[model samples]
Target: MIRDNQKSQRIFWSCILPEPLIAKYGLSFAACNFSFNLMSGGGFDKVYSSLPVYVGGEMDSDAFADERFELVYDKLRKRGGVFQKLAVLKEQWMIFRKIPRGAFVWLYNLNILNALLFVLLKVFRPSVQLNIIVLDFTPVKKGWGANSVFLRLINMAHGRICLASSPLFKSQNSVVLPGVVPQSKEEIPVISNPKASFLLSGVLLKEISQIELVLKVFAKLPQCELHITGTKGDEILLEHYAAIYNNIHWHGQLPFANYLELMHSVTFQLSTRDINYPENECNFPSKIIEALLHNRAIVSTIHYPQLNGLNYFEVPSDEEGLINRIQEICELSKSDMYTYVNQGARVREIFNTEIWNRQMAKLEANK
Candidate 1:
C-alpha cells in the first residue's frame, strides 16, 4: 500500500478518465483505458495528480473536473497542426516544471509526448523519478536503426518499465504486470443458458483473417452461436458472412455496459490472434482478463507465459485446430463447464487490485 504521506507526491500522464467523461465523449479505447487505470492505481478518487493527454476526443474542461486528481488538460484542439503540437510541447514543459521535485512521474506509453517529457525531466527535474507503463511493444524493422536508437534511449531514461506483456527482450528493470479485472458500475448477472455460445470482441481491424477463420468454423456447426462486436473491421466481409451463416452474429459496436452484459452471457470468450504475428508476442489479450473476471472460459491461440498455470483452452494457430477445439468445448457437459468457470473465478481473485498495487510498489521501490 502507498503510504498516505506519499499519496499526493505522485503524478500520472494519462489518457484514462472517469466513467462520466468516457460516456459523454464516447471514447474509443475503453479497454486500454481500463487496464491503464488499474495498473497506475488512478481509478480511485483523488488517488494521484493527473494530466490528461490526448484521449482521442474533445473534452469540456468543466466535465473533466473531478476530485480524482489535480487535473490539468490542454484546451487546444487535438491534432490540429504544427501549432497544436508546439502548444502541447510547451504545455507539457510547463506542467513538469510545476511538479514538486522528487515526485514520482508515471507515463502511459512511449509516445512522442511522453518521450519528450521523459527527456525534459531528466535534464531539468532530475529529482523526479520517471516510470513508464508499456502496454505493448512494436519492434522496429531495422535493427540498430534510428528508431531503435530512440527507443533504447527512452528505455534507459525510466527508473522502471512496467510491462503488461512478457518482455520481448530481457531487462532487469522491467516487471510484467498482472491483468486487472475491471469493476462494473452495475451488477451484470451471468446467464446459465445451456446453449453453446461464444463471444469475439475488440478492435477487429487487425483480426480480419482470424474473423474469417472463426466464421468458417462456426458455419459448419450451425448448432453453436458466435457473437462478434466491436469497431473498425471489413464490414462488407462481415455482412457477407452474417448473411450466409445463421449462427454468426455481427454486432458492429456496442456501449461498454452492453458489451459487458454480452460477455457474461456467453459460454466462452475467443481470441484468435495469429501466433506468428510479431505483435502477438508483445501484446497480452485484454479480453482474456475480462473473460476470467466474468467467470467465462477462454479459447485462445496466443500463449500467456505469465499466466501459464491458469486453466484455459489453447488451440493451434490454424483453422483445423480451432475447429477441433470448438467442437471439443461444445461437447462438454454442464459439470465440465462449471470446472472452467471455477478456474476463471480463481483467476479473478489472483489478479485483484491488492495484487496490482503490490506489483506497482516494486517499481516505486526501484526509484
Candidate 2:
C-alpha cells in the first residue's frame, strides 16, 4: 500500500495493459503493450510510484505478478452490451474522483476515452498534472477532419505531451520521446542462416499493401523465408499468399516469448511501412527498436528524422527496391553480416533506460 505522504508523488498511468491481457481480449494492437513493458522495465513504476489504470480491455487480477504496480479496470464493462459504454464512463468518473489532487497522471494514447479523462481532470481536478503519451497520431485527412480537430483540442489540455513520433502540428509543451530499448536479460546472438529469414510484425491491417508487396517479393525468392506475425487482419489474403509460396509463413498472434524467439532466429527484422503515408509522419515503427536491442539487422522502408543515425538498410517503398535490398543482404558474407548486426548495438547506448528516466524526471520537475 502507498503511504499517505507519497500521495502527491504517485503517478496514475493509463494505457492498454500487458501482452497477455491484450491477447486475452483479442485486441488487434500490440505496439502499446511493447511500449508499456519498456516503460515498466525502464523503471517508470519505481521512479514515479505509478498505479496502472488500464484502458480498452478488462483486467485479469491473477494474470500479472507485479505487486509494485496495481492494475485498475472497469468490472461492469466486462458484462458487455449496449450499457457497456455507460458503465465505462461511470467507472472513469469513479476513478477520477479517487485520484488525489495535485497528483501526476500519464495517459498512453490520444483516444476518445483519454480525451474524456483529460476534460474531467482539467475541469474538476485542475491541480492534477496530465501528460499524454502519443504513440500514433490520427491522420488529418478529409474523412478524419473531426477526429483531427478533437485530437488538437485534447492536446491543448495536456500539461505536457510526450510523443513517440513527430506531431503534424508543433507545440511548445510537446517533446518527442527518445524511443525505448527493450530490456534483454542476455545478449541474443545473431543467427547465421544460409537462407535469409525475415520477420515482419506489427498491425497488419494498416500495412496490407506493404505486406502484399513483401509477399510477392518473397514468392520469387524461393531460397529466402518470410515470417509474418500479429493479430489477423485479412486472413483470406494472407492465406492465399501462404498457400502459393512455401517460403512465406504467417503466424497470427504468437505468445510474446514465442514471438521474441522467432525474432531472434530470423536473419533480419523487416518493416515495410510506406514512408509516403501521412500517418507514418506521426508514428515510428517500434519494431526497429526491438530488432536493434536484440542485435539484429533491420531492412525497412520507414524512416523518420529522429532515426537519422540508426543503422538500418533503407529501401524505397516498392517491390523492386525491396527485392534488390533483400538480395544484397542475402549475398553478404558471414563476417559482413555479423558487422551489420553489431552496428545495432549502438542503439542500446543511445536509447538506454537512464536517458528515459532522466527525461521523465525533467517532465516531473516541470510540474
Candidate 3:
C-alpha cells in the first residue's frame, strides 16, 4: 500500500550510517553496505528505527545485522560449510518476508543482474524509494557485468542520489554529500617522541598491497612503532612483513569506537592504497580524515586530489621512496611536528560537518 502523499518524512540513510548523523539527527538506517566494518561507527546503537530495515549482500546470514537478504544462491558452499549455509538461508527468508512497503532500498555497489532485477521489482511496487549513495562508478563498467544501458535505465528510477565526492557525480542530476568529519580544537595528546609512533587502518583489500611496502619501510626505521589494524586478507602479506620486521605489530580489526580510541595512542598515521584501482584515485579514505580530525600526521600515496594542504607525505609506489619519506618525517624536529600540526588543521576543512550540513540542507530545500 503506497501512501499517495508520502511525507518527505524519512531520510532513508541507506548506506553505512556515519556517526555524525546519528549523533546529530538520530535517524534510522538501512545498513545495506557490503561489509560489517562499514556499519560499526559511533553512536550506531542509539539510532534504532521503528521503520523497516533491509540489508542486501552475498551472504544471507544475520551475522552482520538484524535484517538482510542473500544475493547469492549458494552463500554457503563446502568451503564455507553446509550447516552454516542452511542457517544463513533460513535467516534470509525471514528477512525477505519482513521488508516494509515504503522503506528505502539502498545500493552501495550493485553490479549483479539479480540485484538489479530485485530493484526493478521494488520500483514497480506501490511504495519503496530507491535511494542510492554512489561511492564509486567502477561497478557499472563493462567487466563488472553491469549492462551499461540497463544501469542508466535503472538509475532513472532513483528517488535520490547522494555522491561521496564531487567527481563521483558526473551527471547534473546527482549532488555531492561527502561524509562529515568533526572539527576538534581541543588539545590532542602528543606522543613523547611523535616521530616514533605510527598508526595504520582501513580495509586490507587486495588493492592495498601498499601496506606490505609500508611495513618493509617501517622495518628499517627501528625508532618507529608501527601499529597496523583491520582484518587480514587471504594473502597474509602482513604476516610476511611481521616475520621480517619485528617492529610491525598487527592489531586485527577493532570495533569502530575502539579504533578511534586507539588513534589517540599513536602520533603518526598511515593510509596507503595502491593506485591500481581506479576507485582509489578519486575516493577519499574516511579513516585518513578521522586521523586528521584526531590530529595525527598522515603518510599516504598522492592519490586523492583534496589531500593537498595536509601534513601528508606522499612517495612513489616503490619501497625505497616510502622508506625515504618515513626517514624524513622521523628526522624532523619537535618544532617541525608542530608545523605539521598546523598544516593538519587546514586539512580538517575538507570534510567539515558544517559544510556538509549546509550542502545537504540546500539539496533538500530544492527538492
CA displacement after TM-score superposition, residue 19 of candidate 3 (Å): 11
Candidate 3 residue lDDT tens string, 21-97: 32222222212221222223221111112111222224323323544212223333323445444534443343334
lDDT of 1: 0.65
CA lDDT, every model vs. true structure: 0.65, 0.65, 0.51
Q: Which stretches in model 3 have alpha-carbon errors above 4 Å?
A: 1-7, 13-131, 136-144, 147-169, 182-193, 234-237, 279-282, 308-310, 342-354, 365-367
> Where is model 2 more than 4 Å wrong at Cα?
1-7, 10-12, 41-68, 142-146, 157-167, 191-195, 206-209
Per-residue C-alpha lDDT of model 1 across residues 191-220, encoded as one tens digit per residue:
365458989898685542377777778888
How well does candidate 3 score on lDDT at residue 236?
Answer: 70
What lDDT, from 0 to 1, does candidate 3 have?
0.51
Give TM-scores for every candidate, taking all chains together and pairing residue i with residue i. Answer: 0.85, 0.84, 0.64
What is the Cα-based lDDT of residue 173 in candidate 2? 59
**Residue 282 shift from truth in candidate 2, angstroms:** 0.8
Q: List the candidates ranked by TM-score, beginning with the highest.
A: 1, 2, 3
lDDT, residue 312, model 3: 67
lDDT of model 3 at residue 144?
Answer: 32
Q: Let me know the TM-score candidate 3 reaches against the reference structure.
A: 0.64
